[model samples]
Target: MADELKRRAVHASGAGLVALYLLAAQFDLGLTWDRFQLLMGLLAVGTIALEFLRLYVGLELSLYDSLTREYEQNQFAGYGYYMLSMTVAVLFFEPRVALPAMLMLAIGDPISGTVSDDSLKFVKGPRVLVTMFVVSALIAAPFLHETPLAVVAAAIGATVADGVKLRIGDYIVDDNLTIPIYAGLLATLVLEFGPV
Candidate 1:
């Protein structure tokens, strides 16, 4: 029970980053995409280095226990995947696409996770998917040009990607990586090519 609460707190903290980005944009804090990319890159590198140490040098950390699962014992934690994907998204896409993508990844992923927990009294599966889609769409609406279609496609794509845990041989692909890349790609493609 304590672990579940800690996990939720961590998820909420990650979701809070969406607000920081929004506030920076609103307050005109000069938070450009380039700077954001730099930030994410640094974080990604740091996470990778720490994970290496944790695996090789016997770096036993309590925080990691709260954040990671047995699947991540010899792999990068979700936070690493999150930073890496965010950096890639910022680097490959323009601000308009990347911003909404980040918002969906930051906000939508946490919402889906928090509500999907079985111990929370909610037992319906479709309800979780619907809630995830609706929340993602709302998050993307403010930034997406074709708000309805683009946001809907992004929401569906992200939710689907998040639901499926992929594996390449022995390496499990975390949703942290899939969520932003899939969501950003779908949103960008729909905005660029679908239904002008």
Candidate 2:
């Protein structure tokens, strides 16, 4: 059941991204060749570095160094989420991408975490996904050209991504992956392509 939700969540997120890209293409909204190059390069570098840390060196840097450790230890959630979220938000010109990504952190992480217990309540399986949808939509509103519609899309995207996290990302995500992705995708999009 959990795995199914994870698969569905990924499908949702992927579908949303495809929809957004199609919408953008229809509108002729796109980053220039330069931006795409930069983003891809950055993504490649980031991926390689993360693999090194994860496979070669191992988990040396603790999630504890991350502000997340405090919240994880005390089981108090949403503590540093906003600050970190905001920092990442500035990267992408597309509210669509930003919102879903943000929701992954804000809603998905805390809501699904074992914080105090080994299991979660509202385990209808959709709980975390639903929460991601709601929170991502709220955060994405003001950032998009079509604020209202984009918000809805972001929410949907977030929910889907959260559901897929376990199956797709498989917990390979962390600060290292986060940084390079942010720098690569968002930065390139904004710098190379005008704000979407």
**Candidate 2 on 7-27: residue-level lDDT in tens?**
334323422433443465568
Residues 1-196 of candidate 1 have per-residue lDDT tens digits of: 6776676566556555556666888899987656767876787788889888898888998989887866678766776777777777778877767766776677777778766755423233776778778887887788784557888887877777666667799665777887778888888888788887
Instruction: Say which candidate scores most in TM-score.
Output: 1
Q: Pick the lDDT winner.
A: 1
Query: lDDT of all predictions, in order shown?
Result: 0.74, 0.41
Structural similarity to truth (TM-score) of each candidate: 0.84, 0.38
lDDT of the structure predicted as candidate 1 = 0.74
**Candidate 1 lDDT score at position 156:** 77
What candidate 2 gets wrong by more than 4 Å, as runs, is: 1-54, 57-96, 103-108, 112-124, 164-196
Q: How many backbone clashes does candidate 1 have?
A: 0
